[model samples]
Target: ILRETETDVLVSYLPVGAEEATKWYVEQALTAGCAFVNCIPVFIGREPYWRKRFAQAGLPIIGDDIKSQVGATIVHRMLARLFQERGVRLERTSQLNVGGNMDFYNMLERERLESKKISKTNAVTSMLDHELDPSDIHVGPSDYVPWLSDRKFCHIRMEGRTFGDVPLNLELKLEVWDSPNSAGVVIDAIRCCKLAMDRGLSGALIAPSAYFMKAPPVQYKDDKAHRMVEKFIADLMRMDPDTARKVLNNEITAEQAVQIFERLDPETARGVIKAGIFNVEGLTPIRGAAKVAREFGVDYGKFTEEENTYLRGLMFLFYAWTRQNTPNWFRYITRNPGGFLAKFLAPWFAVVLWNNTIDEELEQSLPPWKRDQLHLITGYKDEDGKDIIIYFRGAPFVDALE
Candidate 1:
């Protein structure tokens, strides 16, 4: 179909957590010289390995879950932000969504809903600067009622305390047509990918993915991401498609491209994009290397290019797991930097400084599933969809790696 139609982009509106099917589509897009926009919860854009692949292939990509314009997750995120800004201590919150479409029916199996649950829960919790306990927040599809036929009903409850120890609570019930809720957002995502292709840009589109998807490769505050998207479209609109491509290929040098994006002020960088001063002719996405380093708060100027890339990959991997497992630790590191194991103290150089520190330290401390594996897959019961465990006291580990 792609060869016959000359399709340059592939949009996966596949059902949530369709990992096996999505993996095939990913390969197909790469083989076909096509961009990919994923609208499901199974991760791709957020994964370092795949993001690097798409970038290396010079293909634009966005994912991992598309967000509805006015759905439960978005609403809950806004409320969470509101509570924070207003000096209210948000204690706990939960969102329950029920829909009657086949989308909902497929999700009735609890085991199949892991990614969906994580996507929704993260969308809300990310709004607050403080840590939200896993036990205190719940967000996911609750049940399916066939008679309602494509309509979704969401219940959101928030419990918080305001200044002076006063209790505050909010309860909201949202109803919308499930099928059409995300259509507009997906359409906009399609246009953005086309724009990236036209401008000779590839890899993860950091801004559009944040505003339009639940699990962007880089998560920005919703308002900031929205502003960036607006600026992105407005800036790109000033250049003709062919001229944009020409500028990308001919007008920019790699050094200037990295400086214009990674070192320049945000406003200046957008102006450069608008003025057609930056391009990825020799550079690529996450822009081959620099953008990833800068965006993730690393200063890689002193490091060699290869060292920078390797370090960025490590940071990216660390962030991917930290986003789910140890958000508090992640927050601590990002916010205060010097609070790990020996606060107000230092590792003794005299005690033992060996090359073994790198491998020996992490290998012993991190869980086997995390340290030794590249990917982890869990099985689901055929009847009810609850998770299935596969670990044993002395089992081989190769199967877990895949």
Candidate 2:
């Protein structure tokens, strides 16, 4: 049927927890040379085995679970991140969602909810620096409200300690149209999948998945993921075929981009450098520190104290990531250290006093992205350095910014 319709991408919106059914659909897509967008939690993109299979077949797949634009997961994530950014120690939190949709009804069965629980839990917890005991952080569907018909009501409560160990608590409720809430995001995911196909890229598209899916293989901070999505959308249209291949290198296609990413130790620094937005080349990863500021422009004058501090922390993180992951990357640090701390840290001391970030900064429950795992540290170039595009792996569709 897909072949007859000339389907370019196959999106599976099968019943929740239908792994066997989803896998069957995946095989159909694979057989038909089509990209896939898995909207339900069946682990096609998150699992290494399935990812490898998709990469070898040269097709992109973007999800274990889809994230609605401003849906429950995203709201929880943003609020949780607020606590972290504000120095509030999140002690306990729970998100109880009740909807009138059939999705809520299907979730009544515990057997179908294992993956759902994991997906929702991970989506929110991935933002925290502190680890919550399994019992402390509760995230999952609660009950079905037949009268609410496609309307979801979410109640959230957060308990934590503030400065001087002062007790602080927050509680809020949100009501949204369950089905329509995901329409924008799902449409965007579909478009992104098509974009990946057009580029001849395959496997789990890190940037798109991170921004649009709850259980992407790699989870980046939402702000960063948002920028990555912007760069991703524009990057492809700007790059020619050969150059695009050089920059985006989907699914470890070449293992490394020694071509322009410049090898530090092909063994230790097992990662890909994406210069799609900046359109520059041969830039040291050190200067990548000011990426957020450069990309989004943190107006020091306009930024609140909290915003500046966050930006500073992000810049500092870029420094530590470089020092720990690829020390030799310093060869070009003198070029551009970024506007955030260009004068204070650049030529020498920027990386000196940097402390390590918590591992929870990335994935904690699932496979953490180690040096051996395929890592795509995508960002824009702060300046022009000849038009050079590269990729070892691949992606899928949604115009997130749109």
Candidate 3:
């Protein structure tokens, strides 16, 4: 839909566990011709192939992780930054996060937990303009408790602080609902992506990623990043007279306008059609030849029953001419009228051509004995639908004429 919807940008706030599915989403966006902003920890925005694809599509993209307004990643990053900036040697830090949501349930699959760890770990570590060893930091989702519902609670601890080589400690606890906590940030991302598309800018967007995500390609302070977005939006609004008018009236959907432009591209339109992601009218139907071919693997022009009739005829004749042990041909003939005519044309020792069909006049013109034999073979009723029957010498002919 990113394409045909003429979307300037698409912001994906997919569930946490949807890594592979997110790749598929990116493919759809690229194929459909829309800017993509990934707001999940699926690693696509960070991965080179996805980055290259976005560049090739000429669409702006940002993100691999979304941050809540006051969530764990931001708070953890702040504490980590405070320690480094204050000249206090950091000893240890840990953020234990617990949440109840489908995102949490999916993360229970530890095999899918790698990117999440990388995201949470890097969010804090990246804050220090200097390097920190692996043993010093502890991050990632620790547990899922069903009773909590959508509420998420996080405990952040950093054991370091102050001058004079003094021993200091910090412990913080936070709690909030998971989905709503991130919705505001997601909304901001959506608008930023739209703004990028409006300017015909493509590839990864740095500003929003730095401000709004836990793990952007780069990092920036929350307040600084927020100011940059506000200024960019203001400038973009000024350039578009129509958007400016909307802004004046307080009637603009900053993100939606971008999507409208994206959908107008032909390639994106076709992707929307193929994915059935968008519902439009008067496209091709999934019926008749198309349906049969796709579902049954049977091509209409190749090996249809009528097309293979001659081969069918040969099979029938092979049984009959050799007088092989076979079931009654008449029984078979009665069951399949089309197959009967198909078989009767089989080439063998005899070949007959007749212009007239077995009508009343033709039947009456035959000799009486021949008529009687034909009648008996056809149960005293003409096989070809003539109602004529003949009694011969006061005895019914029961033997096969062949």
Candidate 4:
């Protein structure tokens, strides 16, 4: 039927006891060139052998166990994460589910239930950072009430200790239509498979599987899984072959493609840089400011007349006191380093000390006579090697002056 219909995806929701048969069906689908979406608890997608075969065949596969849109397992996992994040040590947890679906009836055979139990148990326990004793966690199908046909009821309980050894616990019940609870998830998984096929992608799709299945090939945190799925979909939808080719050929970057698509002009680009709206090569703000200034034909190191006067006044104050009573001030500071006089002199000393240290370091690094020639030039320089006065200037302040 898959080959005749030319199906894009084959969704498998086979019965619980048909694990062996399901494997055969998956193989059949792959052979028929149909993308597979396993909506049952079988290891076909997660198992290495099947994954390798599917990759070799160049067909996308998703699954292990289907996840309901709002299921007992998801709820339990979220609550467990909540407890751990809030610093509550979860001492015990359990999720009991009762349903009247064919699935529930099949699970009546305990032999067919081991995989389901493991999948559901791991779904919750994986969210916890600490180890849990096998005895402390209970997660599996409980009973089948035929009259309730397709209705599932779930009871979840969590017991934990908070600050001061205070006891806290949460208990909740959820009632849902068993089959339809997962129907939406199956539809989404099928669509993801179709999307992968459209993109000429094969093998296991990590994001969709992680978001939609209980036992994905690779597990991810719920939020991260959600984000990955979002990105996957966005990438699929936004991918332009021409743009992608250009990016691959080094004609433009992915970011530049986005900017071009947004119709960004040079003026707006400059504004974005000046407004600190973009990160350039992981440059620090000071260095970034210098780069921007150079791009805009501005002097990064050019101090205003007012700033020069202030700096000159500070220099004069330091020189006057040092020339008049150097020995006495040095002795006072040494005796009472935390004193107001010492505190007052500290900033001036720091500036001169740092300047001299930088000068000495530069001189030592350079050849002997070149150091003297280099000392003839002070302040900063542009890329063109023109001398420019260097001063600290905030972008907002510069903008205000403009």
The lDDT of each candidate is: 0.66, 0.66, 0.59, 0.65
Collision count for each candidate, in order? 3, 29, 16, 2
lDDT of 4 by residue, 20-80 (tens): 8998898898889989998788778888888888878878899889999999988888899
Give candidate 3 misplaced runs (Cα > 4 Å).
1-8, 240-402
Could you estimate the TM-score for every candidate? 0.62, 0.63, 0.57, 0.62
- Writing each residue's lDDT as its tens digit, candidate 3 over 357-379 gives 33354334323333343322111
Residue-pair clashes, model 3: 16
Please give the distance, in angstroms, between residue 62's alpha carbon in candidate 3 and its true position after superposition. 1.7
Candidate 1 has what TM-score? 0.62
Best by TM-score: 2
User: What is the lDDT, from 0 to 100, of the residue 304 in candidate 1?
Assistant: 55
lDDT (Cα, tens digit) per residue for candidate 2, span 1-402: 989999998888887888899999999999998999989988999889888888888888899788987788999999999999999999999999999889989888879988888999999899999799999999989999899999999999999999999999999899999887888898988898888778767888888899999999999889999998887776665433433453454312222222222222322122222432112344444343334234433223445544444333333223233334442233233333323332233223212111122223222322222324332222223356321111111010011101
Query: Which pairs of residues collide in candidate 1?
Result: 111-385, 284-287, 284-288
List candidate 2 stretches off by more than 4 Å.
Answer: 248-402
As a TM-score, model 3 comes out at: 0.57
Give candidate 2's whole-model lDDT.
Answer: 0.66
Q: Look at candidate 2 and tell me the lDDT of residue 247.
A: 47
As for model 3, its CA RMSD to the true structure in angstroms is: 25.3
